[model samples]
Each structure stands twice: as C-alpha cells, then as structure tokens.
Target chain A: MSTTAVVTGLGVVSPNGLGIKDFWAATKSGKSGIGRITRFDPSPYPARLAGEIPGFVAEDHLPNRLLPQTDRMTQLALVAADWALADAGVTPAELPEFDMGVVTASHSGGFEFGQGELKKLWSLGSQHVSAYQSFAWFYAVNSGQISIRNGMKGPSGVVVSDQAGGLDAIAQARRQIRKGTALIVSGGVEAPVCPWGWVAQLAGNRLSTSDEPARAYLPFDAEACGHVPGEGGAILVLEAAEAARRRGAKVYGEIAGYGATIDPRPGSGGEPGLRRALETALADAGVRPGEVDVVFADAAAIPELDRAEADAINAVFGPGGVPVTAPKTMTGRLYSGAAPLDLASAFLAMADGLIPPTVNTEPSPEYGLDLVTAQPRPAEIRTALVLARGQGGFNSALVVRAAD
Target chain B: MATKEFTLDDLKRILREGAGADESVDLDGDILDTDFEELGYESLALLETGGRIEREFGITLDDDVLTDARTPRALIAAVNALLGAGAAA
Candidate 1:
C-alpha cells in the first residue's frame, strides 16, 4: 500500500495579502487585487493592471545583507517558506537534514533581478555588474534558497512547466514523501514586475490590455479578454501522513491524487488534455467524478481556454455541473504561484466548509457551469479538484480530500 | 573637492524626497523612530529611498550603513563620511 501525503502547513504571500489569514480574508471577501502597475511605468505597455504584492519588503523578511544577492521571487519564496516552516512547527535544526526537501516552481525566475543586472551592465559597465546575477535568475533559485536557508538537505528540485509547475511541484513532493522523504516544502513564487518581464509577458498575447480593474480579466464571462499578470503565491509543507500523525501535527488535507498531461501541439485544440488530466487525477484518487464536491478551475480568461475548461468539467460531471470557482480572477494570474494558491484556497475551503467566490465574474448562462460568484457560499465539501493549464500546453490536476 | 556640508534642513529635504514622504513631514522630527504603520513608508518605499540616496550621493552604502542610519541626521552623517572618503581616494 502506498503511503499518504498530507498537507501540514500552508503559507501564502499573494496579491490578495501576505500570510494565510490575510490571504484567506481577502479571498473569501471576493476582493480583487488588480490595480495600476506600481513597480514600473506601464504607460508604454498595452496592459496596465496587475495583481502586484503590496508593501512587500524583502529586508523585513530576509537578512538585509542578503537582499541584494537574491531575486524578489526568491525573497517571496523564502518569506512564504519561513511562514510554512513556522506553521508546520518543524524547525530545520530539529529534523534530519536529509529527510527534508524542497520542490518549487518559478515561471519567471528572478526576472526583476536579472533585469536590474542587465541595466547595470548596459548603462555602467561589466565591472559594475554583481556576481550573484548568474545564479539568482535561474529557475531553481527558489528551491536553492529555501533549502539553504532552512538547512534542508534532501532532494531539492524545481519544475518549469509554467502555471502547471505549481501543482506539479506539490505532486512531486508527495511522491518524495512516499519514497521515504520525511518532509517536503513545495509551491511557487513569481516576481516578474520588472519592465523587461512585463515586455516578455506581453509577447505571450494572453495579458488583458484593459484599463479598468473590474473588467480586466473575466474567465468564463462574455467580456473575458485575457489574463492579468500578477506576483507572489503560496507554499505548502507536505509530510507523510504517518510522520505527521506521529508528531501530532494538524493535517490540513490529504493529497489523494495528482495527474499531469502535456500537449505538444499547443493552441491546436485537437486533444482534450484538461479532461485527460482530470480523469486521471480522479481515477488515481479512487473517487468517481460525481464524488467531487467542488472544483478550483484554471480560469484562463481566454475564450477558447475557458470553453475548453467548461467543456472538460461538464463532460466529467455529466453536465449537471459542480460548484466551480476561480479565485485567480481576483489576483490576475501569478504564473507559477497560481496553482499553489488554488491548492491553499482549496484546503481552506474544505476546512472551513465554504466555497470562495470567483471575483469579477459575470457568468455566461451558455457556459453551463455553476460558477461561484459575488459572495462566498457555504458547503459540505469533503473533496475538491484543483485544475491548472500552462501556457505551453501543460495540464495538471490535483485531488485533495478532507482529513478525517 | 571636499565633501559638501549639508544643513539639517537640506538633509531633511533629501530624506523626505528619497523616502517618498510628503512635504508636510517635519524634517527635524524622529522619522526613524516612527513605526512603519505611523510613517506609512513600506518596504518598497525604503528600497526606493536607498536607491535614490545611492544615486544622488554616488556611494554604495554597506549593510551597516543602512541599518545604523535610521534617521535623517545619521544618514546624512554617513553620506558625508562616504563622500569624504571618495574625495580622499
């Protein structure tokens, strides 16, 4: 029999708010964090609004000396990891270093820092560039930084599958636990607020060019144009169920199943990758589609992507529709941070017995999906399906069950 | 050229502008002792202030400088020292 991996602790530094309490409060209230860009001038860009993390100070959470060497994304990851470690009550000094590991995803790796370094080199000279620039911008900086800071010496790794990387990171952590790793810190953090990062995102053609925050990105709605980019996200501590029980730790939820699929021909719309991922996850969880109480959708906010997700959900649940919510609409899209935040929200929803509303949603009756909107809804949710699709055609689904 | 001597008022003006504080703030007051909530200067604002100071003074502030130079007076003193050293070099 395979061992179960359960979520023991959760930490979030989202656009909604930093830490779990603030994030949950803002999310449950259906407050949108999207606003005008404050990090840089967005006057020249087509898109204006973004879900930027407000009042974040890297030095407050990290050592002042280390601030210049690390990227904003790594700093966010470190802060979230600190919260998760404290929440889990597992000090790195107490645990066997080899037993704990880190698995994180970063869609945009140290973009702000990389851009800064490039500017320094361009404007000044090569001598003015800092040496830390080489590694700070790498995709694995989050995992590396978390491991080094927390003294985690186990299998540290990173996933780069865009948005799906967040879910995949948690799923991979679950696998590590089953394979004898004692603890896994998994999730994602993205800080791509620099001018260069914004330009790179504009090339993707998925960003909403709208001026108003309310109508910026509306998934499954007729007015849906595209997604608004954002920063920060959530991180989770996943421990083996037996280990958690031994320690008398609180179990948030059980990682019942995870499924991932990739379509090489992205945007072709030939294969139903979302359906395959969802079906596989449900099958792995040993739960029928009808047993799912709620679903946290990807909510891409693109017409075709939204339709694909709606069709996938309808096909699985027999068109009767399950209560679907996309909280990402409230925080634009945090790239790699999107899925983990969804997972965190899913865990909280199951724990609180409520479904959070999808903000800024003007539901289309033709979509045939029960999109939760306006206000939070109370429900007896024991199981949830969290879904995400990456820009380059990666799809991931995770099934979480309430701890008994 | 030797380091430029700045009056308390000049230091205050620089702090207000560098820290992104409103003009109404008192320059002679205890800005550093003020809590973040009271001052309304967030982390981003501090970073921006640090960058502006570095560019304006043409000196790289060590971590110690940032930590110890909490008030406008202390920060100005530190800047003067760095400028003096630069002139000596």
Candidate 2:
C-alpha cells in the first residue's frame, strides 16, 4: 500500500493570534505581532522585543489536573493538538488507539519550568523540588504528553534539531504514516519567553536589539541585523491520504517531499548545504524549479546567512525567477516553530489564492530576486517550498502541493 | 514557643494551592476521609502538596508520606505526629 501524507487540519498558537482564523488574518494583512517583552522585565537583556501570544490563559483551555505537571510550552502544545484534532474532526475515542501517533519538535524543553525548580533547589534545598520536574523538563515531554492525553500508543517521537526540527518532525510523521500509522499529529509550538530562555537566546548573539517593533526583524534587506525571537507556533494533523478520503476528511495539502542536510564546520571551507537541500526536496517531489510558485525563506536576517539563502534560491530558480517571502517578519522567528508555521501559511495561501506578504522589509537589490513585501499578492499557489536552518548548521526543506 | 498542629484545614488549603481541586470534587465538604486520589490529588499532586507543607511549616516529610497516608485524615495525623515528635525533642 503506497501511503501518501496529507494535512487535514492546522492549529495555530501565534504571537499575533491564538487560532488559525486570527493568525491567517494577521498574516494576510501583514500585521506585526512583535512588541516589548512583557512576559518578563526585558530591561535586564540586550534584546527587548519579542513576539508573544496575547491573552492566553492555560486555565481557560485545559483541565486543572494538568496545570502543575506541564510547562507553558507543553500547555500550548496540548491546546494546539486539541484544536488540530477538532479541526480535522478526529475523535480519538472513535479511532483505534494504535493507529494514531504524535511527532513534534521542541527546541528549548520546559525551560521556564526547569528555571523555577532550579531556583527552589538553590535557595531552599533539593527536598523542596517538585517530583514533576523529572519528566516535565525532558525534550520529549510534548510528544509524550500529547500521546498520553489522546491515548495514542502508536509510533511517536520528538525531533530536536533547533529551528529545522519543525519541518523534520512533520517529515518524520509523514514517514511514519507511510510505514502504516494511520494518522499523526505533527509540527512545533514553542514558549521560550522566560528569563532563563531569554538569557540563553541572547548567548547566540543572533537576536536583533532593535526596540522598534516594525523594524526589529528584517530578512533579505540591507538593514537586516538579527532575527527576532518569539513564542508560539503551529500544530498540524496529518493523515494517510487513503484513510482521509475514506473518512471524508477535508484535505489542505500533500506533504510531497523533504530533504535535510548539515552545513560544514565553520572553518572547514565547504559550501553551505541550503541549496542542495532545496534541490533534493524538489527532486524528491518530482517538481522542477519552474513548478514551484513560491519560496518561504529561512530568513536568518543576518547578512551572510541571507546571502547564502538568496544565492540558493537564485541558483535553483534563477535570479528574479520566483517570488520569495518571509512572512515570519510579522511574527518574529519562532525557533523550531518557525518553519511549520510557514508550512501552515503555505497551505492557507493555496486555499485563499493570496500569497501572504513579508512585511516591513525593503529587499536589497543585490539579491537579484523578486521579493514580495508590504502587501499580499494574489496568485494561484499550487506548490510551495519551505526552508529552515538551525543554529548549528542544520538545514531542512519541505515541499507542499495543493490537494488533488 | 509551641509548634502549630497540622490540621485538615491546612491540608485542604495546600491541596488547593499546590495542585488545585478537580472541578467535580469539593475541597470544602467533609473530605478528610476521602482518599487523596478520590479527591483528584494523585501521587505527584500529593508530592507537591507535601513540598509546600514542608516549606510553610518548616518540617521534613518522609518521601513515602503519600504511600503511608492515602487519605486526608491520615496525612494530617502523620504530619501532626511529626510535629508532636519535634516539640518533644
């Protein structure tokens, strides 16, 4: 049985919005969600701005029993998973337990939770620590929690490749479905807004210190400095195409192809792997450069990374050949959550026939690409390629095509 | 100075503060005889509650406190036994 993976539902917990309706609206209109960090006093940090989800109280959406055991990220993931399953019209009680599984990406695992516990351990003693800390701080907590909550006992896993892990997790879910899992909940959601997570992010020196929200994160522009970090992301429901059709599930798009590569050691003088990863994904999807309607760039917002990405796009699609956009400019880079959100936006674009804009960026002419900025463009987007690169040379590419 | 006794009221407050009561389970009604699990306080919840009790009351609870005291009344008795022992010392 040749199984194909298709996206049946999308759950978004974005800095700009809590659900798909709001997220898509904000994306389409190019509204910025970036603002001063209110989760903590940012005065202690160099980069003060971030994209944070507004008005999300866990108690409103989850059970009281779950509050103490879960971190904020896990709470968000559980809610997103619930929304995605509901959007896909999936009732876990009705489905076979072993047929469904969960695959998710986590970059910083329960940092805020760990930070709180560590404070107690230092000030009070080890006996003061909560026993829940043992599993809550694990990177696989999201996947485990989601699986446990839904009673999904099938093949489940968590990918931890930093930013690239989102696409990688979705691809892993696709792989699992192809191997016989009927349905999988996949993608990434992150909440690294606390003081410890902030200091850790600042250590990378890749965060833009710009205080102005509109100009904080500018990818593919001359004024580009560093990317803005943000919280929240997207979760997706992926099902085997035949099973979805049999159940009469609404299809968003097909997860056509995936490719991943790691860049060479910094001083090794080897070429960057972003171009090869994109090419490999296109080949895997049997898509030519001309067939791809749009490219969702990694958009590192650093000069060298931007140059490499532009060169990769230009190398494969040719200069000014395809329209490139970084819709993340509106929501800030969500670390492991970024690419999956872009994937969600791609599916939405195909459905709406409107390409979301990469707001607030004036593309540098040197890139020689047709960059979409400041406004949404109407187009028949059948195939979209999403790219992501992690901190330590992890590069991943995924291709999605409108459902047949 | 006399050590304050650990009571059912204190356990009720800690249960609510540490893990929160289940919506269906009432913390106010006579719950002293109810099992911690029946009150929606699982092992982890009890562990957290014990941690809070230790901090607020300045007492060291044995790790098996939850295992030994399955009900609210038993937990309070165990805590007061420790308090009475400390006062005598």
What is the i-RMS of every prediction?
Answer: 10.2, 1.6
Write down the lDDT that model 2 would get.
0.92
Q: lDDT tens digits, residues A47-95, model 1?
A: 9899999989886777543565688889899999999888888888998
All candidates: TM-score: 0.82, 0.96
**lDDT score of residue A103 within candidate 2:** 96
Global lDDT for candidate 1? 0.86
Q: Please give the C-alpha DockQ score of model 2.
A: 0.60
Q: Calculate each model's fnat, 2 decimals.
A: 0.00, 0.59
DockQ of each: 0.04, 0.60
lDDT of 2 at A62: 89
In terms of TM-score, which candidate is strongest?
2
Candidate 2's displacement at residue A300, Å, is: 0.4
Task: Single out the weakest 10-residue window by summed lDDT for candidate 1 chain A.
Answer: A59-68
Tens-place lDDT per residue, model 2, A225-263, is: 898999988999999999999999999999998999999
By summed lDDT, which 10 consecutive residues of candidate 2 chain A come out lowest? Answer: A127-136
